[model samples]
Target: MRIYLYLIAGITSALIGWNIGQFFLTDLGLFSSFPELILYPCIAISLAIGMVLNEIFISSPTRPKLCLKKAKFPVLIALGLGLIIGLFSGAIAQILFLPFFGIPAVIVRIVGWLLIGVAVGLAEGLTWRWETVEAGDKKRFLHRLIASIGGAMGASFLAAILFEVVRVFLQEMPKNLRLAEDPIGFSVLGLFLGLTFSLTSSPSYLVALRAGSGFEYVSQIFAQISPESINLSKDYPRIDQSVLTFVSDSSLDRIEEGLSIKLPSKGSFKIGSNNDCHIYIPSLPDHVATIEIKSREAILIPHVLYFNHIAINGEDLKTKKNIVLKHNYLVTFYSILKGENNSENTIIINHEKIFRFVYYNRFFDPQG
Candidate 1:
């Protein structure tokens, strides 16, 4: 069902983009001479639109951050292979059919459409295959190549049918209309090519794969934490503010006043007099404090701050403090003489984990 929906969305977006391109070309009076050229941009635009809509409406909850950085090499290779196959096939088709049909102009046009469709399909298919399928030996490469070629052929056939339909429609248009000329034919042809391109675009496949894999990872993490059972919505933290402050030894002068800080779900930050700390608090012992913020809560591990008369929420921190930070929290450091340090401490909250939990829970465990 999801696959069908994705296909429908892609086709619809391609048709819309095709009409838009045609309108532009007709309005600008550039449709007659360079009708085939419009297909390039139309196809690109349609594919982008389809992908974005699918990501936003169809598969947003499970979507993951695509590792585009790692996929660049495979994408480039796919593009190159697709171009080569398209050019070679197009050249052969033109050579074989031009003389047999004895219509140079028509043969050239058809060959161009075939080239665009096949090339776009193969490129997109290969890229998607690489991302969805695991990387393996040369056998996997052969399988991917075959699948990509088959997709390209299917796209080319569909494009051919669409081109004939549009061509027939244009032929039936009123003779007095300006669009009844070659512009109409070419515009329809461009639309056909665009549809073909959208049918095999890689964006939807990659997005869906990434999203599904991300959900699996999240589930694994949750399972590891608690095998019996866990309530993600209840356990996750919903932070409203995230701020951190640094206090110096001097009561009158603060080395650094206050700065907003952001923490990831699973990371640690250190603050001390040494340069190794994320925030340096001068006049305090080296590595005086450490903060570990997880998806559930934040832990403050005080080293020398325990004895330095550091106070959290008016309570002296004689030991480590496990703060259940909500909307707001404050931490202040004081000297032995009960004088407040110049550094300021503030808390910043993040609700990404909580939101993720709620979204998943709503869809996956509604009864729970």
Candidate 2:
């Protein structure tokens, strides 16, 4: 379903680009003749539109945070290469139209347009490659570049077909109404060109990325926090014969006394009393016993990247004491707690058994 949508978008964008290209040909002459004047704004607008669309559809769950930051250098390099190539192609076309070459002006102009389109497409494709390729695969630069160029050429051919159709339509319109003369009208036309190119280019780029090493790298990045990880933590709160319960309903309370219990293969848990005993009762006296629970036993593994902590119920019991049993022998309780060094931290427990861990950045929210 998503693939079809992307294809549709690509086709639509190509049509739009063709229309815009036709307008530029009619109003400003060959894109090669005014490469900087014509191509620069078009590139800027198209890239801006592409970035917005990428953020909306592609970034979440797949691309990492600060994707735009990572893409800056790549985008710059691609755009520079495109502009240089476009200008050079245009210059060549102009030379071919001279008396020495004896090439028809119209033919030269048409060829120039094709070259510019191909250059821009290739550059745009290269930009996508940087975002999709894995850091480890940077050595395979030539292979990725060749693949991007091929995809760009295909996209440009599609755009050319659309441009011819738009040109015919514009020719049918009244001469005065067909072209924009004022600044406001030109701005609108530029925006239209940008949106059209973005729609077409993004879909094509995504398809190319999927077909090459791009998809592999994107999958690798997302696999770190995939559904498997979430599922592993989902079945954390089950109970059996033995339960390890906290003394206070709030995990923020300082626990001075520790308790020891021979938890069955399946473990159990409950909240203990606030009094000196600080233990969950109603179980066999022989099986459950209270001892001095040290602060270090209740460990907080801070996820610095996410600003949350995975509070292990008794990590020390498994690691230090080497306690073992059946069924993995490890009873894990996942909780999201918000705190900093020597601060009043609180854990938000939801009824759905899902933990919402929030950490307040002291620099951002001092009161938190």
Candidate 3:
């Protein structure tokens, strides 16, 4: 099953890679937008690269029998073999295509060669030590299919995020001074460039493997975290006066709806639900109202400031005057009072563990 899975991934990704290479070759002179041309290549390449690297580079790093049984270092063997084939094939393609595409011929053919190496590596992993299934099904075809898809998807997301970060940083470079190219914030170009270069990495395969393995749930959680962090509903609402935000079930009507997630790549990371959004208010005004989590036990997540008071079940809960929410390796919960410009914010009874407060800060004011 696993072997069959690997076979399918290799075949599909290679086809995608080939078509993309051809598209770039023929369309170099066309005026069409870049997004249409670039996305496929990036996705295909990233998917294939991730698949290949996982097989050749990471094959026997964990297994013990391979260390003593054959004594042949796998990485060196694979590298030597892959390098030879990659060079020969790359040279042939470039030598032929350069006449038609000119300088771009060299570039596209080199990319094609990389994609070919990916295909070869993926195919080898499927046929050789991959076992297709377990001792019984390890070498089987179905399981391989599931695993291959999972690996590819996971790698894709990581690739996308890494690309996004790089794109944002590069756009700010002083060298990109084409004021006429883009009159706006220059964000679109950053996204495009980042996604393009990132595809060469093939993160989807790596991600797909995780999706099929023990880390599937973790991947799902992280994928959801990125988007939920940007949801508009999570944004701090504009208020005419003091506003209390409670995410608990009873505090809101739609607390349990419309938050399904799809990874567009793997199963373990397929459809899921996640709605924990972190809120950040940089400069709270003096006239602003109090901010509270209002849970029975607030697991004071990291990044909290000025926790001066505490309240519990009832009575003057002998709360401490500290902001450290980490108590004995645990995220402790508590009620708190944070001082603002002239007044202080307070918390009441709750079942949860910890609460946090950001006080109205003005320490540099030497005026007593």
Candidate that scores best on TM-score: 2
lDDT tens digits by residue: candidate 2, 1-368? 33344444443433444445557866768664544345433433343334334422442324444555655766576556655765576567657767998886546645654565455445554554445422123433445445445554444444445555565676787877456322222233333333444444332111000011101112334657685633222212211222332211222222221211221222122321212222221111111222221221222222222112112222322222322122112222232322353244434421122221111111010100
| Model 2 regions more than 4 Å off | 1-65, 99-102, 132-135, 138-144, 180-368
| Alpha-carbon RMSD of each model | 18.1, 19.0, 21.1
TM-score against native, each model: 0.36, 0.37, 0.24
lDDT for predicted candidate 2 compared with the true structure = 0.36
Count clashing pairs, candidate 1.
11
Best by lDDT: 1
Candidate closer to the true structure by lDDT (higher is better), 2 or 3: 2
Instruction: Write the candidate numbers in order of decreasing TM-score.
Output: 2, 1, 3
lDDT (10s digit) by residue, model 1, range 152-225:
45655565566666667767777666354443443443344344433433221110000110122236587778
Query: Between prediction 1 and prediction 2, which has the larger lDDT?
Result: 1
Q: What are the lDDT figures for the candidates, one per model?
A: 0.43, 0.36, 0.31
Q: What is the C-alpha lDDT profile of model 3 across 123-160, one tens digit per residue?
A: 33343333211112343344444443344334334434
